[model samples]
Target: MKYSYEFYRDHLEMLRIKLPGEIELFADFIEDISIEQKADEYITKVENVLNGLYQDFEIQLNATSVLIKKDMTVLEHFYTYEEPYENEMETEEFKELMLIWKSKIPERFKKKEN
Candidate 1:
């Protein structure tokens, strides 16, 4: 479940502009995973999104796997064939990747000190 992520500066910049409101939540998700008590809370949020209890974000749970994308439509091709994303990673690996990406965000986008 290890992932090889490409650190794209432009993608980070794009998220900074497009998902300004989600930045804090994303950061908190990363932080919550590191804390014992809060980890379940973070997982619950993700599960809510995956299970359709929440629909505010772009995330999909197909069978036992999860997909996070900007556009759920992009998953059509994969769904038709019941395929996992080419870039699929385990949850822990995904958390690690998020941490790396979070570190690259410019200081201005961060609402609180890490």
Candidate 2:
């Protein structure tokens, strides 16, 4: 499956207020997937959240899909604002998307190697 996303000013502003620094963390997670081989733990985190084992965060990732449920309170407020937005992609497509997103991250937000 192919995935696409558009972020409006309001959406970004809301995210900045509601989930500060999450973008950086997300970038780190993307890098970790490649550098640290965290796919298993990433899948476990997704599974745990989906199974109600934990509520550590709103975003979840598994082998096949990426789900982002930022806020359910105002579902469908915007055409782009789908409650619990999910993208199911083949492995290659998903990896491509991750790299694309990783590339878009601002230089200051990228993780520094020791």
Candidate 3:
């Protein structure tokens, strides 16, 4: 099962904490499923960004590559990345609508599409 930061973030409770039981269930599932072999760069990028370890503000990930830009790259290359996600169109205008399944974007980033 692929997991995205936004997915986890969306499901996180009001206090940014996940319920132990919910997590336990996921752990059980993850432990049993054999994930496809992941590349080293993907794992490395997760470690850097998860800690806010970069001088650069942006970090991203696709299933295959870790995108990083500028001096943030360790004496290597620059170009960058974030979590696995899909684009969807819906507005918080209907926050109470219920039954929405994807993660919610912060209101501040919501904008008029060009």
The residue ranges of model 3 lying beyond 4 angstroms of the native Cα positions read: 1-38, 55-114
Write model 1 residue lDDT over 1-114, tens digit each, in one string.
Answer: 243333222333332311122121232223223333444443454455556677623433332223442122121123234332333323444444445544544442334423
Number of residue pairs clashing in candidate 2, backbone atoms closer than 3 angstroms, sequence gap of 3 or more or interchain? 0
> How far does residue 95 in candidate 1 sit from its true spot (Å)?
1.1
Q: lDDT per model, in order?
A: 0.36, 0.35, 0.25
Whole-model lDDT, model 2? 0.35
For model 2, state the Cα shift of residue 51 in Å. 0.9
lDDT of 3 by residue, 1-114 (tens): 122212232222221212232222222112222222332333344345445675332223222122333222211112214221222111121111111221222321244334
Whose lDDT is greatest here?
Answer: 1
For 1-114, candidate 2 gives per-residue lDDT tens digits of 144443222322321111122122232234334422355454455455545676433433332123422211111111224333322323344344445544444442334443
Alpha carbon lDDT at 61, candidate 2: 30
Of the pair 1 and 2, which is ahead by lDDT? 1
TM-scores vs. true structure, each candidate:
0.29, 0.28, 0.20
As for TM-score, the candidate ahead, 2 or 3, is: 2
Between which residue pairs do clashes occur in model 3? 59-81, 60-81, 60-82, 61-82, 67-80, 68-79, 68-80
Clashing pairs in 1: none
